[model samples]
Target chain A: MTAPRSTTTNEPTDPYVDLPVPDQRKQQSWRAQGPIVAMVALGGAVGASARYGASMVWPVAAGSFPWTTLWVNAVGCAVIGVFMVLITEVWAAHRLVRPFFGTGVLGGFTTFSTYALDIQKLVAGGHSRAGLAYLAATLCAALAAVWLAATVTRRLVAWRQR
Target chain B: MNWLLVICGAVVGAPMRYLTDRAVQKRHDTVFPWGTFTVNVVGCLILGLLSGAVATGAASSHVQLLLGTGLCGALTTYSTFSYETLRLAEDGARFFAAANVVASVVAGLGAAFVGVSCAEALWA
Candidate 1:
C-alpha cells in the first residue's frame, strides 16, 4: 500500500488522499458549517480592513510601482509560513484556527488579483520595466519570504522541542 | 464608512472563498491545490473587469472599494499560493511546485488581461 501510494504513475504532487464524493459532500449541510463560516468571515473582515488601512496610510498613486501591495503580499506570505509551521509542528491549532486565521485572514490580506492587475496596468501605461520588475519581484519576494519563514520557524521549533 | 464597505465585501468574499475551496477540494484528491488556483484566477478576472469599468466610468469608486479592494482582494491569495508551492517542493514534488507557480501566474495574468480587454470592448 505504501509503495503504490508514493510510486504510482501519479507524480508526488498528486496526493493519494481520499476525498468525499459528491454524494457524500451533499450530505454536509450548509447550516452545519455556520460557525466555521462565521469565523472565516470575521477574520476576513479584520484582514481586509488591515490591508485597506495600509493603502490609506501609504497610498500609491495610479500607474506607479505598487510597493505597498508587494510588501503586503510578502509580509502576509511570511506570516503564513510561520503560522503553518506552528500549527503543524508546534501547536495543535484549533480546527477553526486554520480556517479563520490561515485561510481567511492571511488569504484576505495577501492579494493575487491586485498583483496581476498592477502588472497589467504598469505594462499598459508604458512602464514596462516597473511592470516586469513588479511581476518578478513580487513572485520572488513572496515565495522566498514564505520559504525562509518556514525554515526558520522549523529550526526554532526544533530547538525549543530540544 | 470606508471600513464598513470593505468589511462587508470581505465578509462575503472570504466565506465565498472558503466554501468554494471546500467544494473544489471535495471533488479532487490531488495535493496540487487546484482550489486556490481557481479562486486566484477567477478573482483576477473579476478585478480586471472592475478596473476597466471604473476607468470607463461604468463603475464607481465605492464599487471598486467593495468589489476590487475587498471582494477580489480577499478572494485571491498570494499567501496560500506560496505556502502550497513550498509544501509541494518540500514534499519532493519539485516539478509540480514549479508548475503551480508558473500556471497560477500565467493563467491569473491571462485572465486579468482577458477581462480587461472584454471590458474595454464593451465599455470603451
Candidate 2:
C-alpha cells in the first residue's frame, strides 16, 4: 500500500464527530420493510455494476487521475438533484419507486470513499497539484451540476404549467 | 466472476448503508449529516485496509471487488454529501456547511491513511 504523504491540517477536531444521537423517528416493525429493502438491494446491485462497467471501459493507470469515478459521481449528483425535484413536485409515483431510484440507484452509483482514496493516491504519489486541482474541481463541479440541473428542471416544470 | 461479487456485495452494502443512516439520523436532530459522514469515513478506512491487503497479497483482486468496489463504494455516497452541504449553505448554515466539507474530507483521508498504515504494519 502507498504510504501517506505529509499533508497536514491544524483544524480543531470536533468531539461530537461520532456521538450517538437519540432516535426521534417512530420505530417501524422490521416486517414492514421487507419490500423496501429488496428494492434498495436490487437497485444497488445494478448501480454498482454500472460503475464497475464504466471503470472497466475507461481503465485508469495506477497513480493517475480517476476520470471514471469523477464522471460517475458528477453525473449521479446532477441526476439526484433533478430526480428529487421531479419526485417531490412532479410525480406522485409509488413510495418504493423513489427509494429504488433515488436512494438506491443514485446513492449506489455515486461513491465518496473511492473519491477520497483517489485523492489520497494522487497526493501521495507526488502529484499534489493534480490532487488539489481534483479536490476543488470536483466540489465545485458537483455542486454546480446539481444546482444547474435543479434550476433548469424547475424552470421546465414551471413552464409546462404555464 | 468479479461481476457476481460486485452484485452480491452491493446487494448487502447498499441496504446496510440505508439502514445505518436511518438509524443514526433518527437519533440526532442535527443537520450535520452524521450518517453520511460516519459511513464515508468508515468506508474509507475499510477500503484503505483492503488496499493494503491487496498490496501485501493477503487479499486478491476478487476480494477487492467484492468488498472495496462493491461494498465500500455502495456504502458511502458523494451525492448526498454534496447535496446536504449545498442545502446547508443555501439555508444560511455557512459555518456548518463549511465545517461539513472540511471535516468530512480531512477526517476521511486521515482515517484512510491510518487504516493503510495499520494494515501495512500488520502485513510487514
TM-score of each: 0.91, 0.88
lDDT of each: 0.84, 0.78
lDDT of 2 by residue, A31-144 (tens): 446677788888888889989999999999988878888899999889977887787679976868766877678778888888888887887789988888887778787888
Q: Evaluated with TM-score, which candidate comes out highest?
A: 1
RMSD of each: 4.0, 7.8
Each model's DockQ score: 0.60, 0.44
Residues A91-130 of candidate 1 have per-residue lDDT tens digits of 8666678778987899889899999999999988999999
lDDT of 2 at A38: 83
Alpha-carbon shift of residue A2 in model 2 (angstroms): 35
TM-score of chain A for candidate 2? 0.81
lDDT of 1 by residue, B1-124 (tens): 8888898989999888877877775665555678788899999999999989998999999999999999999988899899989988898878778889999999999999998989888899
Worst window of 10 by summed lDDT in candidate 1 chain A: A12-21
